[model samples]
Target chain A: MKNQWIHIFSGTVKVKLTGKGIERFLNQLTKNGVSIWNVRKHGSEAVTFYVNLQDVKKLRIPARDSNCKIRFLERAGGPFFLSKLWTNSGFFIGACLFLGLIMLLSNMVWGIEIRGANPATEHHIRKELDKMGISVGKMQFSIDNVESVQRELTDKIGALTWIGVELKGTTYHFQVVEKSEPKKAEVIGPRHLIAKRKAAIVKIFVEKGEPVVKVNDYVLPGQLLVSGLYGNEDDMKTVAASGEILGETWYSTKVELPLKSTFQVFNGSEKRKYSLKIAGRTLPVWGFGDPDFKEYETEVNDHPIKFFKWELPLMVEKKTLREREEVTRIYSREEAVESAKELARKDIKNHLPENAIIKGEKILHQSIENDKVKLTTHFTIIEDIAVGQPISQGD
Target chain B: MAKKWGQYVRKWMTQKMDLPQDVMMDLPRITMIGQVHIYIENHRGLLAFSDGEVRLMIKHGQLLVKGKAFVIKTILPEEILLEGKIDQVIYIND
Candidate 1:
């Protein structure tokens, strides 16, 4: 009974009766099991009373010798407020508002979210959705064709193998599977470590295999550092190789340091902006302008809404604008030369083995380049630099 | 002529002969006793009351009332007996 949709129909009734005559009529109607009330006269000769269809059919005249007329108005549909057929304007607007509220409440989504992927992949997928104009605080995403979204995403990011999307209640969920990358096979064949650059052999360690060069030997780029083949001529064994042959390569480097320099440094002040997307067009809710940091740097961060495409959930990109300051200093020629040599030594030291000991160092040349002094250095080292241990399997 | 025909129809409908009563002897009675209002409904002795207090006796049960002056208006089978100025009513189980 509660689930049934009951339609109410109402119609006005006109009756001819005096004040006392109407009272007697209502009393008789009540006595006959016809439940009604609010009976009142609209004019001098007429009285109106509301009655249900069943009771209307059962109505009967009370007096036999009296002169009274009963006329039934046209049947009207809707509630009492809506059944008034006289006026052009009434409570229709309020009724429409009430019905609209019901529809809006039932259609709204309670939750919206992305699912079925790791944070990284999910972030990428969410970004793509933002590009396609999905987002929060907007109308619920009621896309009928989710396959198209999935297809667009897979086409954009090759790492995603498959994807799925669904709507439950008011929430939208995304399911994604990432494609796995294959591993490279190990190199079991014989291979040798050759010189990657033109440098003097400052240190050498020949373990397992024979060394082609000794310490202090000058070597060029592409020269073999570790020999895969061993023994003198006939006794050479064609064996699968293992073990490290550490070789210290030398580098002649020239470095320059200016007496005056200008560098940009960030002061770390930022302003935030918000944006929204609708129908594949992005609209900025906040104004676009330079950050209000005069001495500080500026950065722009943009974050895409997780469940909504056009809605920005957070700021992701930070474009930092750093202000540069000029600094000046004066140095003697000897100081500048020493500083240049120190810089060159430091750069050359990176390519040598950790245990290599610098035996001697000398400045090969010094010159002026641009606004800075350039000094070239030569370094000598002696150390055991072996990379691999001997691997032997008994037959 | 139309008014005369309507009068004849109304008289015929109202003058229908009453049928013999096929009343059910057993009827469920609900009596509500509260701090303020006391309601009593009896099926055999069709009676109901709501006021300050009411004392009633029906079948084997006895009810005691206490409060201001009370009134017992009408009593009929399938009809209600109303009491005014009733505060409370206590019923003793037989």
Candidate 2:
């Protein structure tokens, strides 16, 4: 009873002995360091007792010396229990496989819901998602995170003004905002079209107005180009002046172009490393060691894991390191001057309206300073110069 | 006569040194809890055991216990625990 707990863990055996000198047999067992407890006598020559499972071997010599017949009644305890479990190993493996299948199913993308989008846009978005491997039944780990999905969708679709992506449980939800055209407000009051800038008239077509200025006539700002009053002064009627006036404008710009330029570009050699982020810490999973490239661009993408409807805190992060190299371009003197004039022309074009056309370009002055070509250039452009002015009572 | 004198001397020493009699006289220590259990220590060996009686060899004599449904709860080199309904306890000199 003193070490009964230890005996249960190591195992215990009940043994029965039948002999002439049973007491001598018990004493011999004690002398051999085999502890026995709960001794009960069946008759004058038969006795039963519990002994440590390990001491069953030591009992043979004692039983032989005492000329007794020994029999093991039962064995019980931890070893027997483990052996019983081993006999049913197939059932244990089946339970484990079932649990793994449930986990895999829970992490799959089961459904996709797109809201606030038309049927056409929804179909287009679903196609894009399929191409990106985010369709139904796809494993969530193999797809990009929600933020990247939102960015990619917005970039690919021209009609979407804004889109929101949310991952809930095994489904992906998309909230879309389509880009709609704004309504225009027209000005129909009696007005006059005046020159908003100083320019020579190139072409003019008056509609519902009287022509006040002719082609090739130079006019100043606020000068009338089209008048809303028509007919004789006795029967004059007022109406809105609406017409297109093409004007030729001049622009002078100063630009400097470097003779030599150096920039970095990707060399197409990339290394990918995958790691797991747990509790805000990164643990490298696949790739080991730092990349050897000195100049490289790093791009990290995180895909959070999900367990049923709950988002797990752990994430799989993929880091891509792309090697880049510096490139240098040297321009000749003539080439630099030409590029400077082109740069000035592009600058003026950006400032003008969409319908403006560049008529001519000329380099008025050119100089070289510190390996850069500087020039002053004049550009000729044709654009609309008329702006509506509401008729005042005094006018 | 010599054994009797030895016992007398040991008893006088026990009284003078305030020593327990069981230790000084080399006698088995027997403890009983009502009539259900008995614990014996400082015994030489188990002489015999049965459901009705238990016998142990002490230093100078054989200690016997008569009980109904007797069970040897524990047995070691120097100790024995007995569980049953005790009827009598006696000692037999060789």
Native contacts present in each candidate (fraction): 0.00, 0.81
Model 1 CA lDDT for position A72: 58
Fraction of native Cα-Cα interface contacts (under 8 Å, chains A and B) also present in model 2: 0.81
Candidate 2 chain A: worst 10 consecutive residues by lDDT? A179-188
Put down candidate 1 lDDT per residue, A1-395, tens digits, no spaces.
Answer: 11112324443232334443543454455456654432344544555544554556556555433345455553434544453533535566667787666545434444447666778887887787767756553344233235666778789977788877775544667777777635577655555556655656655544445567776676666776676676778776644344443345444666778855566554444465555655446577765876555665544443333332223333223344555343456667777877777777778778766766676777787777676787778776554443332233331
lDDT of each: 0.53, 0.89
Off by over 4 Å in 2: A1-3, A14-25, A37-50, A63-78, A116-124, A180-255, A277-283, A334-366, A375-395, B1-25, B29-40, B45-57, B60-74, B80-94
True contacts kept of 1: 0.00
lDDT at residue A135 of model 2 (Cα atoms): 90
Best by lDDT: 2
- In model 2, state the lDDT of residue A79: 90
All candidates: CA RMSD (Å): 22.5, 5.4
Q: List the residue pairs that clash in candidate 2.
A: none
Interface RMSD of 2: 1.4
